[model samples]
Every structure is written in structure tokens, then in C-alpha cells.
Target: MNQTHLATLLAVLEEGSFDAAADVLGISPSAVSQRIKALESDIGRVLVRRSSPVVATESGEVLAQAARRMALLQAETDVALRRTIARVPLSIAINADSLATWFQPVFSEVAKWDNATLRLRIEDESRSMMLLRRGDCLGAITTEATAVQGCEVRHLGVLRYRAMASPALRDAYTDRTGTIDWAHMPTLRYGPNDKLQTNDLDGRLEGKPVNRRVSEIPSSEAFLEAARRGLGWALVAELQGRELVESGDLVLLDDIVSDVHLYWQYWRLESTMLHDLTAAVVTAAAEALD
Candidate 1:
């Protein structure tokens, strides 16, 4: 119920320790503990679980989210009144591929704002929405079109991918009859979370045994480079792979195109900064995605 206590709870969760949060808040560790205790007592529920690095309980998480939203709103109001306020970080989650390609423009847009800062958490598109549910980020670029509770959703567009490999790799896997030996060919995936490569190839096998010869390359640029250098075939984003395809560096393994429909999901708060960011993301997706 107390605004100060709520802020303290949010700070503890973000900083990961009571002492660390105390330093950020310019207060003693004792004061921080007292506030958290007062908050828990007021709510008649334990808000934070005392640990080496304190973690919020399920009920605590709900309050932490509310606290974070309140902080953002207060920061906005301070700026509107021409008061000097510390830069507020707008945390967002995005996939590695999107960061390297269509999402670049969003960074450029954020650079122009003086009152806000960007804190990015790179996760797979499929899992990025988890950050939203956990209140780890204010917004995310995700594969899920369905809105999370207290959030809004917008369909960006499809990011088309092509199954591609080096000419040598393709030739080595192709038989004299022109049928490709997909079951034996090596493949690359961004990481364990990345299913694009395996999903596409597995669909072709139709219950047959798969090669299981897969390499994990986590970085987006490195993943593309590995495929280009003949490490393995992979599903490459069209925007990132087009030049390589044209330059004869990478060849298409098949004509089937994978279309991943992307969406923008954010807290349904009436914040100008969030609105502006959504607009920027929508505009950039329009130009880069299908």
C-alpha cells in the first residue's frame, strides 16, 4: 500500500540483493529491509523470500510489476514537469536474428531520446514472451500473437527463412538422381532454443530417422557465418542471406520457405515512450519483414 515500500521491493528484485538495492536507493541496507518487512506486513503476505540474493514470491512478483510500472509513470511525470530525472531504462527482449536484422532501426530510434535508455535481453523469439510474464522487460518481440494478461499485441509481419548451405555441402549431400540425402547431412542451429533448423528438416523426413548431426552456434552473425563456411546447412533469414545467395556463397537446399510470423507484445500502459517505441518497431518491421 505504501509507494516507498513498493519501490523498495522492485529495487531489491532488480538489484538481486538487499545491500545492492540499498546502494542504488542511497539508503542503508537496514532501511531497505525495514521497508520490505513493512510492505509484507501491510499486504499480510510475504512479498520476498529471504535468500542470498532475495527473490520475490509469486505474490511478490505481482507487486514488483506494479512497482515497476509506477516508477516508469513517475519518471514520465518528472520529465513533463521539467524536473531533472535520471535516465529510465526501457528493458526489452528480442531474438538474436531480429536484433541483427529488422530490429536495428529500433536502436537508432531509441538513441535519439534523451530521457530514456534501452536495456536489451537477447532471447529466442519463442521464449522472449516469458520475460514479459515475469516482468523482466517492458516489451518483447515474440512469436506468440496472443496477448499476455494486462498486455497488448500487434502482428508485425513474417520473417521469411530459406534452407541454405554452401555449394560444396549441398553437392556432397545430393545423389546422382538429384535427391538430397537430408537424413545424413550436417545442420546448424542457433541454440537448443532454436527449433527452426530441426523443425524444418524433421518435417521433410516424415517419421524417418534423422541424422542428429547438429552444431549449436548461438550468435546470430556467427550462425550465418558457420552455414556460409560450410560447417552445416541452416535456416537463414531472407534479409540476412539474400546477398550471400546472390554472391554464390550460399545455395538454397530447397524451395520451401519458412515464414515465422512475428508480433510486438508490450504492457498495456498509457505511456508515451512505450507508444513511440511500438510505432518505431512497427515501421521497421514493415520495411524489413515480409
Candidate 2:
């Protein structure tokens, strides 16, 4: 209910610490603390989790979103009233594949909004929703069909991932019978957080999952490089590897593939900018995804 204090809380959660929030607000750290304390007293609830990098308690997130939504609405009003609004900063979360493939339209759309400036955070599609839920981002491209509460989810398109390896690896590994021992081979992983290979393996090998965990090369480009150098087979996004596959550099391992259906989730706030940007992003994705 208190807009000023609510904005303070949003800043702390966004900046990830009280001192950082103070730097953004041009206020003393003690002042930031006093505002948060006053806000907690007024709301009768603990708002921030006092960690090295501060985090919002569950109710704190709701208040933070409320403040963000109000800011968006205010910006829209200012524009409509023929008033000058400096850059309106909007943060959105996106996965790597989408960023690499269909993001040109997002740039075009944002550029049309003279006052809207964009900051992008990259996370795995499975995890990007967490950033949106925390108010770190207002929208997300994610692999979730169900919307996070207070956000609207739209099915954009399916991003197809293929199990691939270098031609040399496949030649040495796949026999005349086209059979390969997947369990014993080295595997490439995007990161410890990545489970695409595990998910693919689990789907392929019925009872005995290989329990195969290998490399943790998180860079998408480097993952392809490792695959090219025969480090291991990997599930690469179709967009990222289609050229290599066509050029006979990366061999398509098998018919087995992973098609992750991506969804666009955004705050349900009635902001014209969000609506326009969402439409632009979804339209662009349709051009690339199935």
C-alpha cells in the first residue's frame, strides 16, 4: 500500500543486496534498512530474507510485483499524457536457444518503444521462470506450460533438440549394425544443471538408466566444439546445430530427439508495452519453431 517503501523493497530484491539497492536509490544503506523495516511493520510481516544477497520472502514478492506493475502503468500514463519519461527499464528472462535464434524481433519491437530499455537475463528454460517469480524479470521464455501465479502463459512453439556427435565419433562408435554403446561413451553436458542428456537417456534406455554423468561444458558454442572434438554426444538445439548437421560435421545420432515446448510467461499487468512486446516475441518464435 505504501508505494515508496514498496519501491524500496523491489530495489533490494532486484539489486540482490541492501548496499546495492542503496547505490541505485542514491540513499544511504541505513536509510534503505529503515524503509524496509518500516514497510515490514506496516505490512505486519517479514519482507526480506536477511542473506548476503537479500531475497524476498514469499509475500515480499507479491508486494514487489505490485510495485513493478504500478511503475509500468505509470510509465504508460506518462507517455499517454504527452509527458517525457526517461528510459523505462524492463528486464526479461530468456533461454539460450531462443536468444540465439528468434530474438531479432524482440530487438526490433523494443526499439519501437522509444522510452523502453531492455535488460536480458539468460537462464535455462526450465529455470528462467524462477527469475520471473522473484520479480527479477517481468517476462520469461520458459519450458513451462502452466503459468506462475499472477502471470499469463502462452504456448509459443516447440524447440527441437537432437542427439548429435561428430562424424568421426559416430564412425568409430556406431558399428555396421548401427548400434552404439551409449553408456560407456563420454557425454557432454551444458552444466551440472543441465539434464537434457539424462532425460534423453532415460527415455531411450528403459530400466537400466546409464547413470552416466560426464562433462560440464556450459557454453553452448563450446558444447558444440566439444562434440566436434569427439568429447561426447550431446543434445543440441536444432537451431544451433542444423548447419553442422547438414554439413556432415555433426552426425545426428539417432531418431531419438527432445522437443521442448516453450511458453512465454509475463506479468498479467495491463501494460501496453508488455502486450506489444509479447506479441512481437511470439510472432518471431513462430517463424523459427515448429
The alpha-carbon deviation from the true structure for residue 224 of candidate 1, after best TM-score superposition, in angstroms, is 0.9
lDDT of 1 by residue, 1-290 (tens): 89988888988988899999999999999999999999999999998888978888999988888887888888888888878765767989999989999999988898898788988999998899888998878899999999999999999999999999999999999999988888888999998888777788779888698547899999999999999999999999999999999999999988899999999999999998889999999999999888
Model 1: weakest 10-residue lDDT segment is: 80-89
Error of 1 at 216 (Å): 1.3
Off by over 4 Å in 1: 19-23, 26-31, 50-54
Alpha-carbon shift of residue 178 in model 1 (angstroms): 2.3
Query: For model 2, how does the per-residue alpha-carbon lDDT over 1-290 read when each residue is reduced to its tens digit?
Result: 67788889988988999999999999999999999999999999999999978988998887887788887887778778868665567788987667877666779878878788898997888889888887778899998889998899999988899899898877776668879877666778777667666777666666575667488786777888899888988888888899988988898988867889999999988888888888988899888889
Q: Residue 245 CA error for candidate 1 (Å)?
A: 1.5
Model 2: which residue pairs collide?
none
Q: State, as a TM-score between 0 and 1, how close model 2 is to the true structure.
A: 0.91
Give the Cα error of residue 173 in candidate 2, in Å: 2.5
Candidate 1 clashing pairs, residues 3+ apart or interchain: none
Q: CA lDDT, every prediction?
A: 0.90, 0.84
* Model 2 bad stretches (over 4 Å): 82-84, 209-213
